[model samples]
Target chain A: MIARTCILFILPLLLAGNANAHHSYAAEFDRDAPMTIEGVVTEVWFKSPHVRYYLTVTDEDGNKVTWDTRGLTPVKLVRQGWMKDTIKVGDRIKIFGHVGRTNKTIMSILDVTLADGSVLTSRSVAYDIKN
Target chain B: MRLILVALLTFSFGVHAHADESEFSGMWMLDVKIPAEPLAGLLEIEMTDDGWIAWVEGGPAPVTIEGNHIEILVDARDRQGFLFQRKLVGILENGRIDGTLTSIDVVESAAEFGEDGSSWSAEAFVKEPPSQPVQDISELSGTWVPLRGVDFRKWTMALTPAAKEWHAGYDARMDEPQKRCISPGLYSAVTWSFPFEIVAANGKVVMLYEAFNLSRRVFTDGRDDPDFFPNSSMGYSTGQLINGEFVIETTLVTQTVRDFNGEPISENASMTERYRLSDDGQRLSVVLTLDDPDNYERAPIRRRVWTRQDDAVIYPFECDPDSFFRQLFNEGRMQEYIDRTPIRP
Candidate 1:
């Protein structure tokens, strides 16, 4: 109900990119291919390694696309001051992140702006790798 | 092929061995085969006041000689922090050292870094590289982050049959441990390319690892390792200042393969790490050795360096695994997860 936006957005310039030891940011995600997937949250799996959200988005051809978006670990997300119930299934959300190299629908979500305009960030795997 | 003639820099104090022993006592440039990538390093056998001593990278290894045969053991951990050992055995023939190096897995899992018997050859270490002035042990205390590219695992190991089997069917997209909130132990805890602060007391050395907020304490007091210790990802450790370098020996490590692509960690594994600072104290270099005899044919070494970042903040990395289970279920892997995870009675 309360809107708290960009709390984990340390610095826009600094958040440009980062890579963790687990999944190489540059090797796995394409920072050059930034996209926004706006749709209803079909599913949510908030856990370690990362938190994944499956969203049902309509593409250019009006085809339904389920974007598999990821964010920082749940530990990190919780630190950003959100509960496990922050975003639930069927919630309309907008996700900004880099797309996966092999799967266009797989993404490393950077920020999630909820329907109430509150934004939370999973900028843990941000990396400044090249195009 | 990388032949560096290491002149007897500190050989004056060591007594010369017999002709047979002399054949194996010299500097050697080692080139070996592994599954990951091609790797080479300097291996040396020289005499010391106590008798014979072996050197791999810049650390001393335990060596033994019989006739023209040489056997050496050096302990090291991988970039992923799996503790293992290297056993280098060679025989002198045709004026050269030719032998097969094997890795012994201390961890219980059959790691993929095993080689049944891989071929390895070495040339005499003739001339030595210009040595830099050594920094004092006190230089080790500070916040440090890995130098770019230093933390990546370069050298590889030969996998065992079981490890190869796991790796053959492995899928990173679905099975990476971090995907389940399993933060890597020392890999992310100590060498995460993030800043970690080392604070030492008279009795022990404590390291504050930033990535997972992992803290490690290395007891310096003269005490033997516990016969019965609890299993942990971060193994128990002890350390002491040795000749201006900070050396730490760790054991009682919990077997791990969750993060290392199922690279096996034997149940009885141990690790040895030596940390040194550059002459300017601005850089720190660490040589890590993994001798997984169960999985590999030779000792694989990892060398890393870190630079000071005193002002760097140790970030937060709390891992939670509930979502991983949820993902597995959502992806129709609940049965697989349940089957793979074996619980104790």
Candidate 2:
């Protein structure tokens, strides 16, 4: 059981190390600043180069704001057991990601918690999230 | 009994000569070793009444067969979309062909480097391997995946005064062509964690990269450089096998930065690369020397390695630039990025 647990932990690191991501993450997102949002999915663009999710979140003032979050490619997500219908519209989800350097509403997705309580990691394999 | 023995001897000698001549007539899979990367491709050789003709990945080229020596010239494109020519010379022995791969960018040779090209040693096989444990460390062939742990950007250069000034003001977010879905050229392309297939046929070695679906053709045939040509990202390359190392020289490259750190490579920049495979044929090591007097005080050397993965597949990299910007615009971030970007007059 310990060997299996070690394999599970090491496998993600190995797989994440090879994440091409295509563009430089540091160029677009700020690594120092991390954010989490619980919102309802408005749209999902599952395509090549990258996959984007549009979510509607309420700010501290109770004002609703649309956030654009990016993740890995479709092929990569599919390999990770993510399907087009995995996160449907109106599904309330929680997202953990890094905020964009220029855009506050834009973020690079790191992990997601679906309405069903299942957790799915976005393609920031090289990124270490510190609690 | 003496007459029968003499007749048998004559028949045996005739069969041996025939086997030597026909050995090269078939389909061959090639694993070509480039600096830090291994390219896999296929070669098909055929004989006709006119002469010998070879097709490398369905592209036909005329060939000449002289006893154990084979020669051919093939025309193909580099990763940067430049036209280049490859001249290949091979020697058939024991059901295998081993020879040189030379290249000259038809356009760049004429416009820049007078006439001389480059060459490298390449080998061909009837069957792709891991079947037999490789004994020669110099023979590099097969699919090799990038080792992610090795950061190639750690190699630094002593920049020229002008280059240093340029680097100081560079913005990676705005200046990076790769972010715009443009080909990052040869130097940066080699550093990418993408898979590439290398094919050595008749007189040329071809590399098909999964990144942006780019391909580069290195010529091994004995041909003079052209008189004029245009500059491109990958540039024109010539390769030769020297003392068991595949040596390649590239020139007339397009002006571009070497990496995300804003390291620059001028059009006058040239590169020399040496590739060596491990004795097990599982790892390929490359030494790259960058010479750009306009950008660096002296040539900088970079080393990289790739591990052979027979099951690795090269996939299509279809990039959507519009979608990239759409997210930024939709999030109202485009204006902020533009406002913060430094403008150079």
Candidate 3:
């Protein structure tokens, strides 16, 4: 029973190793620094290589800051039933992602919660397996 | 009674041989399993006045059929614009052809057909009763997503000494073009984590990639590469069907790294790509062979498999490198990137 369980766990890791993001997520995003930003969607570019969502959030200083966050490719999002119109302009949503190592307002999105209380994961194969 | 039975057996063998020869003409779906992965392609065989003419994709080659045994030689170009040869030898039985497929890398071998090559067992299937309807050859037109269960970046490459030195000093933060929203070029573009749509029409094929919104135009109208065309990331491409596969040759690409790891491709480097759809049309496979004498000891072959996803939409990839760098500045890591980045003299 122990051997069978080990095989089940190890097999997926082996398979998921190469099935990750096209580019190196670790190089761009800081895995050590995770952040959550709740803001209104300013724009959405639901395109390939990655999907970008711009959000305007009010900071502690009462200044509106726009954060540039991106998620996995549209292909992965489509598999999860997310469409081009999933997030529209002015939609209030919460984003959880890894901040860029050099850029604070740029993030690699991991999960998103819509205003309607729907949570969607934007994790790629590599990021999903690691985190 | 024994002599009469022997005569009947001989007569039945003759009839069966004649039936198998007639059945060899038709469209066949070929499934070949290489050591790394399985490949699918379409083969069409028709009887002509000279002999059996087989159109593998759109490249036409003469096929030799003797009894139940068949032999065909296909002069195919890889993604690098190098001509390679695939020799298929199959035996027909029960409406199925089982054979050996051998690929010889001519550029590496310096011979028309390489002396030592890779061979795999291949099976060709005909549409039997109760089988799904065969997909039209033109159904290769549509959006395709990279079938990502397996990692293609792990393939070993034979880098030259100079290439090895260049790769050793690579820093992903600054050197990786994709990070700066630059086009990853053809080799990386095909296998990137995105959807690429193929539009085929009127002697032209256009591939729209979601990565950087890169688009490649392949002329099938039988025109040679222009003499004075400027080099670009995507390069010049011409395509034709050869041996049941859509073969595209790209040349005059700008000198760029083939992948994120900084494997180099010279401006003179060329790529030959073969795109084939499975019989059921559910899967599309591409075999890309790169020929760059300046960067590698041998031409490397990269195979990519994509599943048909009708609902998958290609989105515009407008990259903002300024925003990316701004984020780094916000995180206080912009200085770190500058420190690690090697300044080219």
- Tens digits of per-residue lDDT, candidate 2, B226-343, equal 6875778888888877666677788888877865445688889998877766676677766677788998865655556677775666666777677667765775668865774553
Cα-based RMSD of the predictions, in order? Answer: 16.4, 21.3, 15.4
Shift of residue B255 alpha carbon in model 1, Å: 1.2
Model 3 C-alpha lDDT per residue in residues B260-333, reported as the tens digit of each score: 43567888899998777777887787767788988876665556777777667675665657655755676677
lDDT, each prediction: 0.59, 0.62, 0.65
The global Cα lDDT (0 to 1) of model 2 is 0.62
Give the lDDT of residue B136 in candidate 2.
34
Score residue B320 of candidate 3 by CA lDDT. 59
Which one wins by TM-score: 2 or 3?
Answer: 2
Q: Which ten residues in a row have the lowest lDDT in candidate 2 chain A?
A: A1-10
State which candidate, 1 or 3, has the greater DockQ.
Answer: 1
Instruction: Say which prediction, candidate 1 or candidate 3, comes out ahead on lDDT.
Output: 3
Residue-level lDDT tens digits of model 1 in A14-54:
32122121233433566455777899999887654567888
lDDT of 1 by residue, B135-234 (tens): 4444578877655333324222445566545544544444454556454555335434455788876778888875656788898887877778786767
- List where candidate 3 sits over 4 angstroms from the true fold: A1-24, A29-69, A73-107, A113-117, A125-131, B1-139, B309-312, B331-345
For all candidates, what are the clash counts? 50, 30, 20
Give DockQ: model 2: 0.04
